[model samples]
Target: MVEHGKGHPDRLAQGEQAITEVAADRLDEDGRHEGRLVLTPDRIYFLDNEHSSGGHDDVIDHTRFQGAEVTGDDTVGTLALNWSDQGKVYEGNTLELRTFKDAIDDQLNP
Candidate 1:
């Protein structure tokens, strides 16, 4: 579950994980704004700007969504940056965002 200050907890589905209350500063190298995100066990999720709840007030000039991937297995996994603007929902145990995007593109183009 992910939650912010004084806000209700956002529930995650079974077999899913969430990175809640992510400060925007954590999103980038420099600490500039407040930003939060929720990552399911499979995919990373970006909340709507409104849902950012004034957390990302300083994160201007950014895209609506960015791509991400998870490496490793059930014992442990690392999240890494992948693609940008690739509309795919995460399910589980996939660490190559570009590969997923390619598959999606091929399916759409073919």
Candidate 2:
């Protein structure tokens, strides 16, 4: 796929700009490789660096984003970000998840 900053070239819309992106550990599956989560002004993007089924990048538009919540703590283990989109749920971990999610949430919910 063509590259567009931190996301795929085919994933963006006109005038869409990436606000922030971070490397996240995919905790929803076993032996999963780390992925990238990109936040644009109007969407949340999950880019798979390497995935078992050969790969797929997920985009959750602001209207489809439900919420992102911390499901664990650094003290106990890696912090996990739990989020839902259009009735599907996803989980990933990143030291930056909370911060990134908070910022994205503001833009999505405001």
* Winning model by lDDT: 2
Off by over 4 Å in 1: 1-15, 19-21, 25-35, 49-80, 84-110
Lowest lDDT sum, 10 consecutive residues, model 2, at 75-84
Superposition error at 25 for model 2 (Å) = 2.3
Which ten-residue region of model 1 has the weakest summed lDDT?
A: 56-65
Please write out the lDDT profile of model 1 over residues 13-72, one tens digit for every residue.
344544233322133443223233443334333443343453433221123335445455
The residue-level lDDT of candidate 2 at 27 comes to 54
lDDT of 1: 0.35
Alpha carbon lDDT of residue 54, candidate 2? 27
Best candidate according to TM-score: 2
What C-alpha lDDT does candidate 2 achieve relative to the native structure?
0.58
lDDT of each: 0.35, 0.58
Candidate 2: deviation at residue 17, Å? 1.0
